[model samples]
Target chain A: TQLLEQSPQFLSIQEGENLTVYCNSSSVFSSLQWYRQEPGEGPVLLVTVVTGGEVKKLKRLTFQFGDARKDSSLHITAAQPGDTGLYLCATVPFNKFYFGSGTKLNVKP
Target chain B: DAGITQSPRHKVTETGTPVTLRCHQTENHRYMYWYRQDPGHGLRLIHYSYGVKDTDKGEVSDGYSVSRSKTEDFLLTLESATSSQTSVYFCAISETGGSYEQYFGPGTRLTVT
Candidate 1:
């Protein structure tokens, strides 16, 4: 079983549209991080949320940690073609890192 | 970009052959990790090192072994390559463990035939 579950598994949208991806788990985490992986590249860190109910904005992206610390969400406003990539959510619980299956986003021009 | 590089960015090996992938870093970080990324599985930890010569098994460590004789280098070896082991492997580094942001290497794609 996957420690973290992400949905929808795949998504495609026209440029300027808005979308949100979710990461959910049954266990609480000390911190949650969001990463974006482009084709032929490693995942890159986008944001890290450590506090429950904390929300952080990165340009057009917004990340929020759930109050219970078992969930997190990433929202993209006015998505662009450059935002096309695989979105993964990860956490380091008990000093071990776990990653979600990831949501593949395709923002068409 | 972090000063991390994985050798032979891509490799193809036959079954039953031993293969070793090397991860070199210049960040001087204390923590190094090896992870394999497969379809529908994101990235799963294979092994990790907290300091030179101090390592631990990750969630999926079977058939794999790691050596960290130096702080700047970590190596992952597959005793006998299997087709199921074909996947893109990534190396990551963190200044400290637990909640610290990790910097990832470009990754090495391995194909076992």
Candidate 2:
């Protein structure tokens, strides 16, 4: 069983479209992080949410941490080809890192 | 750049052979990690180090062992390779104690036949 569960294991949409990826868990975390990874490379941090009910926006991307700190969501606005990659959610529990079963996003031009 | 690198970016080895993957960082981070990424499994932590000679097991510690004798180097070893161990291994580092601002390396593609 996975500690973090992500929805829409895979997503493919055309440019200019909008979409949302979610990560859910029963346990609470002190902080949640989002990362984007391209093929043949490692994941790059996109954002980190530390507070409950916190919402952070990075240009066209929006991130929200659940009020209970047990879930997170990533929203992409006007998606583009450059946004195509694997999006993963991570958290630290018991001094260890746990990652969600990522959502692979493909934005076609 | 986080200044991380993994040796033998791609390797193919037969079963029963011993294999070791090296992870080196130049940032002199205090925390290092070893993880394996596989389809449907996401990124599972195999081992991590807090400081020199201080290491701990992660969720997937079986069949793998890690050593951290120096601040900049973390090594993962497989006593006897098996086909089930084939996957992409990633090395990550963080300067903070809580895994803050963690960064990953290019990864090592291991093929155990």
TM-scores, all models, native as reference: 0.99, 0.99
lDDT tens string, model 2, B1-113?
88999998999999999999999999989999999999987899999999999999999999999999899999999999999999999999998756387899999999998
- Stretches of candidate 2 above 4 Å error? none
* Per-model root-mean-square deviation over C-alphas: 0.6, 0.7
Interface RMSD of 2: 1.1
Looking at candidate 2, what is the lDDT of residue B103? 94
What's the DockQ for every one of the candidates? 0.88, 0.79
Off by over 4 Å in 1: none
Cα lDDT tens digits for candidate 2, A2-109: 989998899999999999999999998899999999999999999999999999999999999999999999999999999999999999887799999899999999
Query: Residue-wise lDDT of candidate 1 within A1-109, one digit each (tens)?
Result: 9999999999999999999999999998888999999999989999999999999999999999999999999999999999999999999876778999999999999
**Candidate 1 lDDT (Cα, whole model)?**
0.96
lDDT for each residue of candidate 1 in B1-113, tens digit (9 for 90 to 100): 89999998999999999999999999999999999999999999999999999999899999999999999999999999999999999999999999888999999999999
